[model samples]
Target: MLRYYGVDLLDLHRGTLSARRVLVLIRHLPRDSALVRALHGEEADWGAVEHLLAAVVDHLAIGNWLFTSAHGDSEPPRPEPVPRPGDAREEETAATPSPRELAAFFGGL
Candidate 1:
């Protein structure tokens, strides 16, 4: 695609490509205005009809997917956390001695 734009592949990877240099390459395009419009997702100029579709495909390929909820119908709902009941109430009702009481009881023993 860069070659199609008359751009050097090495320049793009080297990060040495200047904005003006890229513009110069784009100017070589037969339909510069139409390429710009396609990149921006707008209607292309009549003169650029042949290459406008390809430009749109190229630009849109860089975007992330945007899908509706219905598209992923198989996804399961997230589960809520459940807390376990503590044993404090059961121990108290059963006359089980507290830690302090048990310590004193054992110390006396």
Candidate 2:
């Protein structure tokens, strides 16, 4: 639909939508969608923002299942460990820049 890929996608990409609004839209977006692919690309990782949003989404889903589906009688599932940047197991591990490189990139020591 135009609303999904056009208007809502633009608002999300521009950060013009609220966190909750963005989350809802993001949930409905297929992983193959352009917006999802762009936001979650290897060349353009928004590190902390991505992690926090993922945690919120995961916890929300778990909470909903626990409360509504399980009738508040079951213990919630344990949270998944946060992903480490540059982990050796990653599909594309990142190398830490040297001090000199960092200084050069930052324009100072």
* Candidate 1 structure quality by residue, lDDT tens digits, 1-109: 2636646757866898876777776766653455765664333344445356655664454331223234665643433222122325556768987788898989954
Candidates' C-alpha lDDT: 0.54, 0.64
Stretches of candidate 1 exceeding 4 Å from the true structure:
13-16, 32-34, 37-45, 48-109
lDDT score, candidate 2, position 77:
66
CA RMSD for every model?
A: 22.9, 15.5
Error of 1 at 84 (Å): 70
| Tens digit of per-residue lDDT, candidate 2, span 1-109 | 2546464556656887667876776678765567766776652354567878878887877677667656755676665544544435455435667789899999995
- Which residue pairs of candidate 1 clash? none
Clashes of each: 0, 0
Weakest ten-residue segment in model 1 by summed lDDT: 78-87
